[model samples]
Target: MSRVKTAGALNKYLHLPLVLTAVFILINAGVYLLNTRAGILVSGGLVIYIILILVIYGRQRENMLNDLVTFATQYGQVQRKLMMDLALPYAITDDRGKLLWFNDAFAELTGKDRKSFRKSIASIFNGMSPDKFPARDQEIEYETVYNRRDYRIQIKSVVLDDLIDNSQILERDDQEESSMLYAFLLFDETELNNYIQKYEDETMVCGMIYMDNYDEAMESVDEVRRSLLTALVDRKINKYFQDLDGIVKKFDKDKYLIAMRTRTLNELKGLRFNILDDVKTVNIGNDMAVTLSIGIGANNGSYNRNFECARMAIDLALGRGGDQVVLRDGDSITYFGGKSQAVEKSTRVKARVKAHALQEFIEASEKVVIMGHKMMDIDAFGSAIGIYRASRTLNKRAYIVVDSPTITTKPFIDEFENNPDYDSKMLLDVHEAKEMVDDKTLLVVVDTNKPDYTECEELLHRTGTIVVLDHHRQGNNYIRNAVLSYIEPYASSACEMVAEILQYFAEGVKLKSIEADALYAGIMIDTDNFMSKTGVRTFEACAYLRRGGADVTRVRKMFRENVDDYRAKGETLSNAEMYRDHFIISVCPSGNLESPTIVGSQAANQLLNIKGVKASFVLTEYKNVIYISARAIDEVNVQIIMERMGGGGHLNMAGAQLPKVSVEEAVRRLKRVLDATIEGGDLE
Candidate 1:
């Protein structure tokens, strides 16, 4: 092929031009000879000179062609020898990816000889096409098909200089019309990748294990039996980590720090941290079972940073109601094994201590600003009022921030706003609250602990000293850097928790009828009129409010709905559908209700009265946002289901909202979660 192409090029470039020059010289010589004898002699000399030049040009062209052919033949042999002698696997392919040649290493890598290298290199490797190959010089990592081995590949397109040690080829190799060849050098990376994976699997990880109900469990048994119960619990944990070669040390009476490798941690994640159930079986004559909250930090920073991460993880686990494992990787968090409910503690020591600490913060601040969540419900509003009364007892100027009140709580707020006996100046909007907040001001967040869910996130940011008091399950995005945090998932409502705090406030401080009534109504509404989530402490708080002149008859009248609202409630309930025999799901269409959240909760509460119903879900669409209210009986945990959708509450009742989705879509999503929960044996 090279000889044919060289001959044609030589004929076109050298032979044709020589023939034209010879014809012109002969014409000139003929004219000179016919015109004059002296001119004829001059033309003859010119013809001889021209013929000499032509002879030299032809000889030079022929010699150059012979050198090109010899170089092309030698270049092929040199390239072949170089490819064959390379230590790493190497292959050469044509412009179409057809394998032209391969070295012994490549043949050994593929378990084939040179004779079998007829297919495209990609076909033997991993079906790679020519277009996928690097057009310029590059190094890439890939895995082969035949032996499934990894390799670091270097590919370079063959250029003129590449053909013969800096010698330029006649045609441009970069042009599409030119036939180009690519060379590939593959270095085995399978062993290196295996070592890297083994290092990651053996990386050190730190974890903190907390006994969420340790105090309660220890109190349940006698002093003589307490040591025995502790030994049993310790044995269970030690035995679980024995095979992993984990190091566990008790940091406190109820806390432990564990060090283990990532491989063991992954195995524990696969088991869903079954040690929780194992420890629960160690009964110490307690009515409530023991549980643990574990925090794990993996692939984070160094050892110290991982330990700090573990501490934060355990705090999140406890905030989310204990009996769970929380894994932290930088800003990301994952939860597992939160099936059990948080056990209620019999003691109020923590509450009293928090109340005293809150009082000190209030007394030290120049002014106080109280706020609750957006679309403030009774529990949120009522809790704010309770804190307001506490602030008044300290003789400090305080303000309550409410941007817009919900329909259910608007009546109580209006009554408070009209009463001159109370300080009407205390009621303020978000703008006024932001202006009032300063470095010395204390911002007390009530009902909701999440910064995004507060009445005014800007106001929360303006104040230096802040406090968070909430009863909902601690979500992943709780407010950070609070002066005090009093989150009690075991409490029935934030109102109930606040009411308990109010009893331990400054001596002789009492709540008037209207203030007491608001707090009482908050408890009544959240507890479904004391029909659910009522414990001994829940009733005790209610009794304290009644003793302070809370009028239940008037509070009941406050919750009474008008004819239109009652009809909307009926319409929402009428759409209820059953799934898996005991689960109820419903969606309230848009434009049918002014207070979709309230009606949805009412409908969900109503669904529980039906026979054989284990859980209920009511979805309401208002202002392009779908609000879901979930309620469950003893056998089901609606909080876990709601948390999966980024909402939360207690185990029996929870709520979530989906923005920019239709009611039908929300219902479909809710049903899919319910199906998975049932399929996984998480719900009945």
Candidate 2:
């Protein structure tokens, strides 16, 4: 095999030499065939042929050398262009790891001159050795500082081939020759790192404490004591924020704004932000405990929105009688720490002042008209009669708006029918009331404040001047057009309030026996024979009625029901079901001589017979309207439960009017409210 290969190589080289010799012989032989002149020409031609051959060989060698140089230059230019166009820093190194070449971007990234960069890439990389770097085609990212600025750098290496013919030229083979080790590329992501840091810092959240009863606390304190207490509060607030890198700005005398980065919201779970327990110990005077209400707004979208929510929650906490914390998140509200009872306020001065104001309003109007709830009860009729007498003092035309068929006051109905002066037109319907109503007409609503419950809702709308006298607790649905609203929830009945108002205007007035009897009956029925729900004002109003010739025996007779009605009440109580800790519910079938309200109340009273029962509710159907009557024993808030069904009253006694719903459906809704209350969920 070696011999055959050697012969083939010799033949290929010998052919080139033989072809050159043949071309030289042909040129000399052609010159010899010419004459002496031809022989001289032939000799010159022979010399020229030899010279041309030498010139051709020299030109071929020069062209080969030029081509090699051109190829080397083009290769170098292509490599340089590739490095410049790349987005990352790159470098080329020899077998010994000495930097041979690097891009301009690399010099900028490392903050070093090209000469120093060639000596050491490790100086800019915090002394990281390339020799210690792992095998080629691998990449790593790390953080380092260049020119005192933080940076993130990525380094990569790849193997390059260095060969002459078929043999590798390593530095060990020839001291001056070295093999190419690797080509490295780097990426600078410092701007990306800065963006991530900014995002993390911005995501950190911040949260407030307000003094709710500031005015009530400082009302009786001396100036020196007040100043000291204020300073103490400020110091405590500052101390709480000191370790958190926060600030407490005093925006008002009673309010302070706290600002803190809430990178630790999870750690604050169940921790009291208001700190009212500590503040309450700081006494002002008169044994008045210093109380405060706090508002916390969390997970709010913006700083302005959070501040507004906190402010609103604080106001609600204060309005609900202080000593509480209210939390508001968007539309949701939560409460904590309002276990204390509201302080009883003195209303005698307010009542007296309101009496004078009402007198002026009554005197200025063209006429005085009184009305009450659609189904007029004893309280409603009695309060209207009491207002009628007050109108006589101003010599104004007095009218009572009512539906005669719906009147629950049987005796009063009989009395009006028997009287010669009593006219049927005097008991005006809502339409008739509207015709007589005007801006000058004064409307006095009694027994109830809710507009939908009023007998003459349109009369209120027709007349600009209005007044409301009610004993029930205030609800969201109230008579907004009224000029005078004498709503005293503490008062036993509306009759009591009207009776007191009548006395204020009763200096030189003549007493009417029928009107006096009506008012006395109203006070009796609401107070349950002066045994329950009676206050100091209740008996005082009853005493005024006795002075006006109101007979107690006749008042009792007005409440008399037939034997069958009494039996129905007993039947309702027999079917009651007790649930949860305090609630007792019962359903009574529709047919009965007694009204649903009376049956429901009797059923509620019977459920109270249970040992642990705190509240009782009776749901019964009558004339397509589901009547829900609720009663409680001080501890249970029945009004809140009833309000969820779109009705409201006092804390212990309440009723709701549901439209055309069945007893089963109503009971299901009632159970839902009870479950939510038991589970400590929001009422609405």
Give the poorly placed runs of model 2, Cα more than 4 Å off. 1-347, 404-408, 421-424, 506-510, 681-684
Candidate 2, 1-684: lDDT as tens digits: 112222365456635844876776776677667655776776676678668767776576556556656887999999778877666777766544567777778777666576665665565466557665546557666676666556565555553433443455533445543333655566555677778766544443333566654655565577668887777777776776665566678878877776655443333334544355667766646256666667666557787787787876665555444566676655666555553433333346656766777888889998988889977888898888888878876788888887743324866867876788655555677778888888888899999989999986778788889998887865546787778877766677788878877776635344588888999888887766676567667788888888998988877777777676677777787888878766788876557554656656666776777888888898878778888988766677676788778897766678998997888899999999889875763221
> In angstroms, how far off is 679's CA in candidate 1?
4.4
Question: For each candidate, what is the lDDT?
Answer: 0.83, 0.70
Clashes of each: 0, 0
Looking at candidate 2, the ten consecutive residues that score lowest on lDDT are 1-10
TM-scores for candidates 1 onward, in order:
0.81, 0.56
* Candidate 1 Cα misplacement greater than 4 A, ranges: 1-61, 73-188, 678-684
Considering only N, C-alpha and C atoms within 3 Å, which residue pairs clash in candidate 1? Answer: none
Best by TM-score: 1
Provide the lDDT at 268 for model 2. 38
Q: Candidate 1 — number of clashing residue pairs? A: 0
lDDT of 2: 0.70
Candidate 1: tens digits of C-alpha lDDT, residues 1-684: 234445466557756656766787767777776777766776777778777877887577667767878998999999878878888988888877888888898888877678765778777766578777765544444555346767767776774344443545543445455346788788788889889989988888999999988887877788898888888888888778876778888878888889999889888978878898888898868655779999999888688888899988998889878998999977889888777667777899988999999999999998899999988899999999999999989999888998878878999999988888888788889888878999999999999888888889988678779999998888788889799999988888899999999988886359988888999989998889888878899999989999988998999888888777788778877878888898988876546456768878988999899999999999887777889999987879998789878788888989898999977788888888888877876663
